[model samples]
Target: MIGMSLLVRLALLLPPNVPQIPVLCYHQIRDWRPKDRTADKAYIMPPATFRLHMKMLADSGYHAILPDELYAHLTKGTPLPSKPVMLTFDDTDGDQYSIARPEMAKYGFKGVYFIVFNNINKNKYYMSRAQIRQLSDEGHVIACHTLTHPNIRKLKGSDWAAELDVPARKLELLTGKPVRYFAYPFGIWDQQILPELSRYGYLAAFQLDEPRDSAKPLLTVRRVIDDGRWDTSTLDRYLKHGFGHK
Candidate 1:
């Protein structure tokens, strides 16, 4: 395993030519009902639409890669499959297990799920511990989304441990794997927290639609939210334009 110091050094030395893989971040995977607010619908993907997106990726010959593969490609200049993409789910929603999981399976795709520790098993809407473990068992990467999905910029003192350390330890115990990746709550991050993430053994952290920090690109790995509102064509355009794909 690379130490934190070496990790930072390598990240800084990364070549400009390193491929920018498109990572799609998702939240809920159920239909948006009348009660769902218009603003909130962006995070609530319908089951049918999710299936269509998966099919599109499959037909387009896009292979879903996991974080370890992404890490290796970014840090060690390892080659990836042509048209590699990463599907990542955040917030531990139960529908991900019930709906998204099987749909992705149809295309032989796997995802990285970032769990909000406080929300797990809190109710029917959230994923339970057993389900999380099942994801790990079935070859999905399970990562942290903090203890309560707080905006990390406001954290202070022991707030760091309460949100990051405790939850990460619990996730590691649940999945029986090292929790080495994180997705910022609401895609918010700050430079000060980068050292804290490193201290806790995180090799990389993700944020939504933000420019990566040049000095610490690993800490600010960028992701684009898979908006529930987009059709397959629109998604394709975004993928191409957003990641600079031809």
Candidate 2:
């Protein structure tokens, strides 16, 4: 731990030539209900608050980059904007399309949406195929969340491949674009699943909090979860000092 601290401090002493894009993970965006008992409420951002976040990012000169642009910067030595960040949404929720999309567009930002195949037609809460295509056509990324939103760490080899590959194929068919990125369901993943992801031609995968292997940046990219707790000042602190854990 001491060595790691020294390295971080040493790195901070130097000018940053490479991009350090903070990937923000979000779930739902909707109006808050006072009496709501949903367990996923913490993942919901009120529409008005959501608008504030987008405005703050735009006003602060943060550039919202796409997954392919991020991948190129990380692996292919591509140049990024002066300030770059990735905004991502998980689950196939209707609110993401109806609420977040327009809000993001207001700031001239694009987002990556991870979808759960099973929820499309079965659950009313999820986005439909037509809606998903609409978002993709509008220049947002449609990536794989999972086929059924299962915990990949608990699945065997075949089941893991099915969960990763099936959704990639399904999304590609729907969007007519390659599905190159993935977000683990519930932010749960393990290094053992990397081979399966690679076999499916995934360029990168995202997990919340500390990455499984810090050296493998693409395979285990880190993200910060936002549940509507951030104001502009808090967001500034995050940008300057990180989440403050070390």
Which candidate gets the maximum TM-score versus the true structure? 1
- Over 110-194, each residue of candidate 1 has an lDDT whose tens digit, in order, gives 9999999989999999999999999999999999999999888899999988888899899989989988899999999988898
Model 2 stretches with alpha carbons more than 4 Å out: 1-19, 35-41, 243-246
Q: Among all windows of ten consecutive residues in candidate 1, which has the lowest summed lDDT?
A: 10-19
Error of 1 at 115 (Å): 0.4
- Assess the local accuracy of residue 18 in candidate 2 as a C-alpha lDDT between 0 and 100: 35
Error of 1 at 64 (Å): 0.3
Candidate with the greatest lDDT versus the true structure: 1
Question: What TM value does model 2 have?
Answer: 0.86
- Total colliding residue pairs, candidate 1: 0
lDDT of 2 by residue, 3-48 (tens): 2233322322222233357888888787768775565566888788
Candidate 1 pairs with clashing backbones: none
